[model samples]
Target: MTTSIVIRDEQSADAAQIAAVTLAAFATLEISGHTEHYIVDALRAAGVLTVSLVAEIDGRIVGHIAFSPVRMSDGSAGWYGLGPVSVAPDLQRQGIGTALISEGLARLRAIGASGCCLVGHPAYYGRFGFSNPPELALAGVPPEVFFALSFTGQTPRGEVVFHDAFKATGPTPA
Candidate 1:
């Protein structure tokens, strides 16, 4: 069975639902090593959650993704960080997550992001033009898996440091 989903930017009031979706998305995944619900809450609290997109169907949110600010060492340079992309377990592979990611990336570029980076599955993020940052790989990162895409001059060279909240989990809720 298949279902249709619509993607849209998240509203302020959707915080509760957004957090809930993230919580549910990571409830069963130990890949993150622990629950990620706390990360989502922290992101919301930090006020850096500039971009959020959701995939909804029949009034229910089935997928969610967020974009926050990331900076290079010394915090002098910046790039958008993509993560916590979640899809309802049952709705995985229906393109809901993809839509949310696409919308968020578009929004970031529109808002003047120089580039975007994320710690995610190379196979997945690679499909969207996110490739390892070889120019200035983050310390301890394989570089091949730490992908980046520049919207301006060069893939903003520097280590990819996502929000502190992002490291608290495996991109489940944060």
Candidate 2:
């Protein structure tokens, strides 16, 4: 049976839950450094979490997604990077992640964002209209995993740099 999920912008009260969910989601992923929660916290603290959202079911936050401004080497603006999307391990493949991504993308477009990009599994992101563009790249990331979705009909051509918060490996600074 599928439970109904409510997608909404995250509030301050949801910080700890978001962190817990994030940690649980990436806990066993071999490719993860297990620092997703820290990255989320750093983004929030740095004021660069352009779009932060959560998926709730029966008043419990089971999933979270974050988007932040990305710098394009070709001087392109209005583009954002998507990442660290997390869904509870037990809740994986239940559409919670999809809901968070869909709502987050809509929110970004509504705010005039030109596009969004991410380093993710090719098969997973392709269903959401994300594609790997030859001209747009994320250094050190396999081209197959770097995907972009252009909302404004113009895909940026250059290197994509996600926010520095993605490098956070410890507690948020005071």
Candidate 3:
């Protein structure tokens, strides 16, 4: 596990490994409100997925992150929303997830995305600059657990509907 793990764009061939990692990570969550596995499949099938990146150690996949298109309520702007980033449970806290997030955000920014939004623990994501901008709102998302960070441009306040896949796979939080 000491060898440097490489972060690279995911290929169609990596689908199974990706799913396995996702299942492992989501299982650790306190809630199963979201079907992490189905969401990834739907995102891939829907073609909204913008970035699919993976981490590997000695050629075995260990972590992953997916970014997809999202919009504000006003539709005034569009940005990539980060989600469902996962690392094999055994790999947690090894900085594998951190590398995936860092590299994925940089890639999204390089592609001209204005920002990234997500639902996650404020404490963990805050360390990476994920926060809810008072000026931005994704309706139906708890203002507390909901988080966002900008790469550039204004992130407007509005209802945030994560792709339909999110709903189909994970029950929406009331």
Candidate 4:
């Protein structure tokens, strides 16, 4: 039997579960700095978490994804950054993360976003239409690991600066 998964906008009550899922997802990822949960919290606290969604199965939160505005050095507008998507470790490879990414990308397009970029596994994100564009770069990040998908079909040319929250290294202060 196939499991049913529901993807929906995150509610305030889902905060703790989102953090737990985020932490668990990246806990064993060698490339992960393990500060994803902190980044999520900072984005929310800074009111820059433009799109935050949680995946639910059996009424329990099992995955989370976040999208926030990104600034292009060229001054192009309506671009966003996708990140920190997480699925419970026990549920990995069960399509939970795929469902979350698909739904999240649809939501970004619905919002009139010009494009979305992310630093992710090259093999995984390509299936979602994310590609490494030589015209755009995120400083300090190699081109191969950085990917972008242009909803408007016009790729911005310049450095992409994700929100400062991406630098979050600790929990948010009350």
Candidate 5:
């Protein structure tokens, strides 16, 4: 059976459901620090979530993806970082995450973004035209897992600094 999946921009009301999906998606992944939801929240709070999208099936958010601007050591502009993409644990192998990523990248390019990068599994991101460029690095992250896709045909050289929100380990203090 083919399920109809709708990919759309996130609305204010989807915040809770998005967080739930993000938490459930990374809960069992050993590589996850279990702070993905917090990172999303922080990104939203900081108003730097350049592109935030949600995947809906039968009116429920089942997956989410976020893209945020990144600062490059070489002063490159229009570069964004893709990360913390999430899909419901039960729906992992489905195409939901892929759909979200495709749409998000399209939106980024439509807005004139020069490039996008992420720290993700090479196996998965490679299919999306992402590659580990020796010219780009993300500090302590291994080169094998850091991927980049240049929309403008020119990859930036130097370090890629993701938003500070990536450091969120918990909810914002009240």
Candidate 6:
């Protein structure tokens, strides 16, 4: 049977659970540096997590997604980066990730965000209207995995720089 999932903005009390879920989700992924939990914490501490959502099933947090401000070399504004999206390993392929992403994108638009971009599997993001535009790119990332979705129909041209919080690979200094 499928469990009911509730999507909502994360609360301060959910921070620890969110970190656990993120760690579990990416633990076995070969490409993951296993630092996603740190990234989320860094984003939160830096005050740049434009959108942070969690999926809860019967009071247990199972999935999470984060969006943060991104800078475009072409001087575009209101663009955000999507990533560190996590779902419980056992819950993979059950629409939890999809729900988090869909809701996150909708929330971004509601807040006047012009666009969102991410480096993810090409096949997964296409369903959400993400495409690798010729004019927009992320340095050091392959074009195929760099996808962008423009809510205002204007795609920016130039390098996309994700928030510096993405560089967090360990605990933040006090």
Q: Per-residue CA lDDT of candidate 4, range 27-104, in tens? A: 999988999999999999999988899999999999999999999999999999999899999888999889889999
Model 5: lDDT of residue 159? 98
lDDT of 2: 0.94
Selected candidate, larger lDDT, 4 vs 6: 6
Residue 108, model 6: lDDT of 95
> Could you tell which candidate, 2 or 3, scores higher by lDDT?
2
Q: Which ranges of candidate 5 are over 4 A from the true structure?
A: none
TM-score of 3: 0.91
C-alpha TM-score for every candidate:
0.84, 0.98, 0.91, 0.98, 0.98, 0.98
> Residue 26, candidate 2: how far off, in angstroms?
0.2
For residues 1-174, write the lDDT of model 6, one tens digit per residue: 278999999999999999999999999999899999999999999988889999999999999999999999999999999998999998999999999999999999899999999999988999999999999999999999999999999999989999888999998675
Residue by residue across 70-160, what tens digits does model 1's lDDT show? 8876454548778778887877777787888888888988888877887767688878888776676766667666778778766655566
- lDDT tens readout by residue for model 5, 27-136: 99999999999999999999999999999999989999999999999999999999889999888888999999999999999999999999998789989999999999
**lDDT (CA) for every model shown?**
0.75, 0.94, 0.82, 0.94, 0.95, 0.94
User: Could you give candidate 2's per-residue lDDT for residues 41-156 as a string of tens digits?
Assistant: 99999999999999999999999999999999999999999988999999999888998999999999999999999998878999999998999999999999999999988999
Please give the range of 10 consecutive residues that has the lowest summed lDDT in model 4.
Answer: 1-10
Worst 10 residues of 2 by lDDT: 1-10
Residues forming the 10-long window of minimal summed lDDT in candidate 6: 165-174
Any runs in candidate 1 off by more than 4 Å, and if so which? Answer: 74-78, 167-174
- Listing every candidate in turn, what is its Cα RMSD in Å to the true structure after a full C-alpha superposition? 3.4, 0.8, 3.7, 0.8, 0.8, 0.8
Clashing pairs in 5: none
lDDT of 3: 0.82
Better of 1 and 4 by TM-score: 4
User: Model 3, range 70-93, lDDT digits (tens) per residue?
Assistant: 866767565777888999988899
Clashing residue pairs in candidate 1 (N, C-alpha, C atoms within 3 angstroms): none
